[model samples]
Target: MCLLIAIIIYFLFILFLSTLLYPMPVNDSGITRYRTIPWTTLILILINTVIFVAWIGPDMYTQEAGASGTVEYGPSPDYMGKINYYGFRETTLHEGIGVAAFTTFTAMFMHADIWHLFGNMMYLWTFGRRVEDACGSSRFLLFYLLSGVIANVGSVVVTPKLDDIPSIGASGAIAGVMGAYLFLFPGTSVNCLWGIGSLIRLPIAVVQLVTSQQAKFWRWTVSVPAWMLLIWFVISSFIPSVETIRSDQDTVGVNHLAHLAGFFAALTIFLFVRKDLFLRYLQGRSL
Candidate 1:
């Protein structure tokens, strides 16, 4: 178990570091008209961060009691047990619908590690504020929870045979937010940090020598259409999900199907957004 944990951490670490080489969303062109402050988005990010740092901190780095009155940090067995017990699982799905349904909610806030939490929270921060602005805090909160539940259900439906594997993370919920962003603010642009130059150690002086500010900016950042990025998210997930199912592989990896499900489920934002915004969307007006 210790070895497994170490390997997982190593893998997560590599993935986390790899982000420096790829384009990552840094900001968006979407504007929040309804609320000046996205209180709900902020609250959600704070809650998720606090829960991981406080509640799951011990799970990842517990001070284990040892001989000679010594204590060493390691993964806590009790904490791991708790996660498996509470996280959405196949047993929960087969035994009782109510209990399994409850796990979906618990699992949304639980994360495997810091990198997992960081990635989800970053995506949430990128796309959630505008979505919250469109739906309002209360409605956005409800929509987020519901999207998580639906995403879990979608995962269970896709891989029902993974009996002991637990599903956890806010990616599915954040995927919904991305989908909502695509739907509600299709015209907006997502500004991403394109670090390929830094990754390859390309001389920035060459680009800096150029007089155009836009050229210098393009050397480090790129602005992509909101719809393109969001649609690519769905397409990217769908291809892997299909390939995985077709190959009949039992290996554990990302739950791409959950992302797809959440993305589609969020298209129903028409039902969750404020009436005025939905009317504007219907009328084909700039939002």
Candidate 2:
């Protein structure tokens, strides 16, 4: 049920974004151009991957019998609990802030599962390269860490009482990369896969009735402008942050407030330090 609700919410959010900012022309042969090898982004991805492999392992699927006599599926509970010791907790908001300061940086490198690591790395690679090019590698690394720290702080501020739950993942820092990407490459295009293969799969009977041959599922890649994609992401995170605050739920899940905070932090930093890049994009000059 939770998975269903999450899928529905994600689908609706994507639909809404599509309506607001339709994808650009399909560029099957478009190539990514970078001024420098995004060493920082690559290093970040490598570090995160190594940590996950060393500690969390690749297998995220686990099952157990539930009270309803049905199998419940989720990540390994033991690993999740173990990782909390390394993740950022709300108790770090005040009295323990000094002692737990290390967790702010450590949590950005930790992930709960393969999917979590892959998704964050994918976004980081997609957006981090451009931002690194704009700000140079050293500054980019500083920006990424700062954004993540600020994001962790934001999460603590929003859920000060929910200290027992630990938040982990590099998404907050990746969100900052995306925020920087929006300004650095406003006119650039991003490739995204869209489909409904997982939402509704027809049974063999229905498939046979529809066609003699077996149904082959597929998804198409569409290219969208950078600004539109980043804006959609920011808005998506913002809505959830607001909803989470309103409901005051004690769920240890995606930290949307952290994502939002990281995004805004990077945006502010970019504006202050690299305003020229933004102005160049606005003036219709490609970087």
Candidate 3:
């Protein structure tokens, strides 16, 4: 029963990804001025990729000891258990304060799988460049790190203290970028690709084989206002968070409170320091 439910959840996640829309500021035509090189965004993507390859990739791809002391590789059955043994945040709480603090930061760089890393980099690339352009590279770097830290802290605070499940990924920080983009480029039109031919095409392709007639795959671009996309994401995160708080469903994955924390942190900062930018953009003027 659990396996069936897992398969259903996986399919639903794939379906969500297939129809998902991403912001494409570059294809926005005259909406945004490409003022900066966005080297900061590129550097971040490079850093995350390198860390994954140098650190996590070896364990993921190469043969290693499993939780039962057996050898395995390439999607090790006990991969999650093994990773949690290293520096996962929830488990680190039992360790000393120094260890817990270190894990909190390290967990931000760690990812569970290739798909997790890829999805995060995609979102970071989508909105990180524009946010970096609005704020200088140095400030953008600071914002990203601070937002991620706050997000983790929020996760620790809101989650059950006894639940020692490890959480790792860049979703919270990328959500912060989306929040900043919401205020900074609300009026900007972003190009997006819709239908099954979207970013996660490989998974959708497999799904097509099982339900060929029911599956409809098409590739096309649509321009949408940035506010609409950002708002939808924030609300989606919020609903799940509320549900989690109200129920004992054992759904311990995806820390929605952290996403909300990072988002609000970025949004609040922009509201105070970059209010003028918001006003100017709202008035249809370039920053």
**lDDT of each prediction vs. the true structure?**
0.78, 0.71, 0.69
Q: In candidate 3, list every pair of residues with a backbone clash.
A: none
Model 3: weakest 10-residue lDDT segment is: 23-32
Clash count list over all predictions: 0, 0, 0
Per-residue lDDT tens digits of candidate 1, residues 37-77?
A: 88888898899899988888666767767887798777688
Best by TM-score: 1
Task: List candidate 2 stretches off by more than 4 Å.
Answer: 1-34, 58-78, 93-99, 196-220, 250-252, 271-284
In the order shown, what is each candidate's alpha-carbon RMSD? 5.9, 9.1, 9.0
Residue by residue across 1-287, what tens digits does model 2's lDDT show? 99999998986675545434333222222233445787988999899999889877744557889999999987776677556666888665445753376888989998877667766887787777767777777888999998999888886687666565788899888887777766556677777543332223335436765786665554345555667777878887888787777777654378988899889877655543355665766788876
lDDT of 3 by residue, 6-115 (tens): 99899667746655644433334233344878787898889878888887776675576889999876665445555675444655766553356666667777787776
Tell me which residue pairs clash in candidate 2: none
Supply candidate 3's per-residue lDDT for 174. 78
Q: Give the TM-score of candidate 1.
A: 0.81
TM-score of each: 0.81, 0.70, 0.70
